[model samples]
Target: MSTLVQLVLAMLTGGAFSTIVHAVMNRRRSNAEAAQIIAEAAASLVGPLNERLGQHEQRIQVLEAENAHKTTLLDEAIGFIRDLLAWAGRLLPGERTPDIPDTLRDELQL
Candidate 1:
């Protein structure tokens, strides 16, 4: 081959190789930057989500405490009414309030 023709061929090959390498490097850098941005977005959301979860837990505990208190009050009221029924049964045996069976009344502690 002529020297000038060989030189032109070499220049073309070098230019093509340089272009391919640059494209590969640019794609890799872009991918890395995208991954970093996603990580940052996730980190920013973590604090607010954790705080909301903690607040919900505290509210659930408060509601549970109030429900327990109400349950105790209801239990006391039921016991008082049961005692009143037992006393009435004893004091008014002749009045015929209802035909409650003796075994059932004993089971109820009446």
Candidate 2:
């Protein structure tokens, strides 16, 4: 009877040990899968955000270049208009508008 009881105890202990080990292995596998999923999600999100950020930077550069060109053009136009107005003011009231002044052509950087 004692031997029979020992046998049953031994079987239960072996089953319990195997169950614990199996549970631990399953948990490890699940954790690895979770980590992989997290890494993939991060990579996916980062890839597009990085691409968009690059595109935005390029767009900003283009806009800045356009602004500079516009500013230069506006400055030239303002300078020309000011010179023309000053030259016109110098004319006699009834004088026909004179030919475009040499000073204006000379001063124009274009």
Candidate 3:
């Protein structure tokens, strides 16, 4: 029940109880070392993984910018085509200009 009683019982067992205690302690130490090794491995892998993620984000931003520029060029081309169609109609006889939608008129400020 008490510490002294336990020690006396262990001593009467010809040191077998001490050997079991030593094995249990050694196993606990081994498990702790294994956990430390896993933590270190995870720490070593994180830096390069984070760097790759940052590079991928930057590449995505550059692609988005290029897409936006292309979209702007296509919008300008559409406006130019609309203007050319209207001018061609004006130069002809009784040709009415194409009716532009209000959404396009507001967006292109035409």
Candidate 4:
């Protein structure tokens, strides 16, 4: 009777230990699966976001190049206007010279 009771108790203990181990393993597997799902979602987002960033960089480069071209054209136009003004100053008669009087010329040393 004593040996039979010992055997039954041993069997029950072994069964309980196996059940606990199996539950722990199942929980670990579920956690691993959840981690895999999150990693895949993050990877999927990376591709499109990287593509958009590349496109934006290219657009910025194009706009900068266009702005540089416009600035050069504007500089050239301003230089041309300055040259024309200088030429006009040399060609046109001065107001004081045309209005000078003989008496004032001798007094003012014109």
TM-score of each: 0.63, 0.63, 0.67, 0.67
Query: lDDT by residue for model 3 over 1-110, one digit each (tens)?
Result: 34575577588875688667667777999999999999999989998999999999999999999999999998997789777876777688488667777767765454
> Which regions of candidate 4 deviate over 4 angstroms?
1-13, 95-110
Identify the leading candidate in terms of lDDT. 3
Instruction: Tell me the tens digit of each residue's lDDT in model 1 across 23-87.
Output: 67679989999999999998889988999999999999999999999999877866776787777
Q: Model 2 clash pairs? A: none
Clash number for each model: 0, 0, 0, 0
Position 49, candidate 2: lDDT: 100
Give the distance in Å from residue 40's predicted Cα in candidate 1 to where it truly belongs.
1.5
Write down the worst ten-residue block by lDDT for model 1: 1-10
Give per-residue CA lDDT, model 2, range 20-61, as digits (tens): 666676799999999999999999999999999999999999
List ranges where model 1 is wrong by over 4 Å.
1-13, 92-110
Q: By descending lDDT, how would the candidates be arranged?
A: 3, 2, 1, 4
Best by TM-score: 4
Which sections of candidate 3 miss by over 4 Å? 1-13, 93-110
Model 2 off-target regions past 4 Å?
A: 1-13, 92-110
Distance from true location, Cα of 13 in model 2, Å: 5.4
RMSD of 4: 13.7
